[model samples]
Target: MAMGKTPGSSDDEGDSAGFAEINITPLTDVMLVLLIIFMVTSTVITQQGPGGGTKTGLKVNLPKGGSADVTARTTDISVAVLADGRFVLAGNVVAEAELKQAFDKAKEQNPDTVVIVQADEGVSHGTVVQVMELAKQAGLGQLAIGVREGN
Candidate 1:
């Protein structure tokens, strides 16, 4: 009787070694997609400004002034006075009568809250002062005026 080769034994005709190659194309594609997602999110966060609050879309021509340390804080409230005598608080249009109430609510949240007034150059001086006065009545003592830095 002739003896046949064992089933577990490797012969010269067939190599039993499994595939050693690894495909990295799928991994690379997933990593690139994640990188793009992070890039877009970071840009949106930065554009929201330091305070991370919504900014008004009004096109106000800010007055040019000398540079100063006017960094926005988390406890700061932004108010925009439009040339047409409209008041916008934190990106929402509010009536003049309700402006004081808004400031009062902000003061209730934080006693050290600072009110930043951003009035257009075409707005009347009295309008700006009146806004400041309302903030004071709301018990918000800290106030700031927003201005564009002159070259």
Candidate 2:
């Protein structure tokens, strides 16, 4: 009797070969998901505007100037000086002495901590300077004046 080869059967050598084509469906799906995530996050960040999204909820008329934008950092301290002469440190109303103590504590935690002072346009120059001076005295060398970007 003669031996016959069956359909879909390999030769007696028992060699098997796999498809060389690569499947990219999973890769494409991952890349699309990552792209969507990045787009959503970027939109959220831009909507938050500058000041690192640290909303102190104290609305102050920021003086418009041609100063460069300062990127706020988490390690930075934000102090708001209202026109009524009250100081809001990190969203809490604090006296000048308390503000100084906060600055000192911040300096102790991180010598490179930056102090961002946002004073109302009606606030006296002396008041703003006082805040800056306190920050300087606390050994926090980095200081920034918050201002709206305009002419």
Candidate 3:
């Protein structure tokens, strides 16, 4: 045996100690699993809430016989669609062209506020959708369509 040499190795051998390497396979697998879980959960959360509760904010007549009964929060921004095709925002009548501006102002005032869409029974579905779309364009992600309780 020579100096700094293993007993089982021949004299012609060099440095027998190999380089140390870290095995990150397990870490990478765990990270990928966690990423998948987060992606699925995020999609579910963005689609809808648990019970799909809706809040009302105006005198508009809502359709009856809904399973859910929800009340409006005081801080919520109200956008009302009247039967005459006019839009009422926060108790004041606003023109269709100003709808997005109104919603944007409301959102700026309360960033955490949700938009409550109160559409009368006689209002067209397209009008309601337009209001909701304007609210979305104003950066208001949270919204609820109003519905009245049935007898």
Candidate 4:
């Protein structure tokens, strides 16, 4: 009787060759854990800033490692932003687009005027930022945001 070759088998019976794609579930799990860790750590880092006290939404202890910067004197101009995006200075409601001129007038009277920005919790961040830009254009060197001490 003659020996016949196996149709689908390799001639070298003892050797094996194959390539297979592996699933990425394990890698995905590891990335998710790292993401969670970074999220928690970032929250902790922003908590403490200069002045030895913590205010709501403001930095507390000085940021780590980098040289600390001394902030310039804030001008005494109070810009109150209401919840509805109205810009008010000294109790007068000013339109959002007219802030530059108003700030110029304030600066002309007092060069040392510091712009203090006060915003309600319900007010949008964009409204507050607009007021800040106006203060800068008004020729004031100092800009500070007002925040509650606690809560």
Q: Give the top-scoring candidate (TM-score).
A: 1
How would you encode candidate 2's per-residue C-alpha lDDT over 24-129 as one tens digit per residue? Answer: 9999999999999999988766644444234576688989987757777777888888998899876678998998898898888889888888889999999999
Winner of 2 and 4 under lDDT: 2
- How high is each candidate's TM-score? 0.72, 0.63, 0.55, 0.47
Worst 10 residues of 2 by lDDT: 1-10
Model 2, C-alpha of 127: deviation from truth (Å): 0.3
Greater TM-score among 1 and 3 belongs to 1
Tell me model 2's lDDT, rounded to 2 decimals.
Answer: 0.80
Question: How many residue pairs clash per model?
Answer: 0, 0, 0, 11
Question: How do all the candidates rank in terms of TM-score, highest first?
Answer: 1, 2, 3, 4
- For model 3, residues 1-151, the per-residue Cα lDDT tens digits are 2455544454565544443356999999999999999999976654433221132223677677575544556667767688998987655678977778767776887887677777888999899888888888889888877666777
lDDT of each: 0.79, 0.80, 0.70, 0.60
Question: Per-residue lDDT of 1-151 in model 1, one digit per residue for the tens?
Answer: 1136554566676754444457999999999999999999887665554441435555678899889567777778888889898988765689977888878888888998888898999999999999999999989999889898999
Candidate 2 root-mean-square deviation in Å: 7.4
The deviation in Å at residue 32 for candidate 3 is: 72
lDDT (tens digit, per residue) of candidate 4 on 29-145:
999999999998877654432111122233222212333232324235666676776766654667866667767876887787667676877777787787887778767877767
Residue range with the least summed lDDT across 10 consecutive positions in model 1: 47-56
Ranking of all predicted structures according to lDDT, beginning with the best and ending with the worst: 2, 1, 3, 4
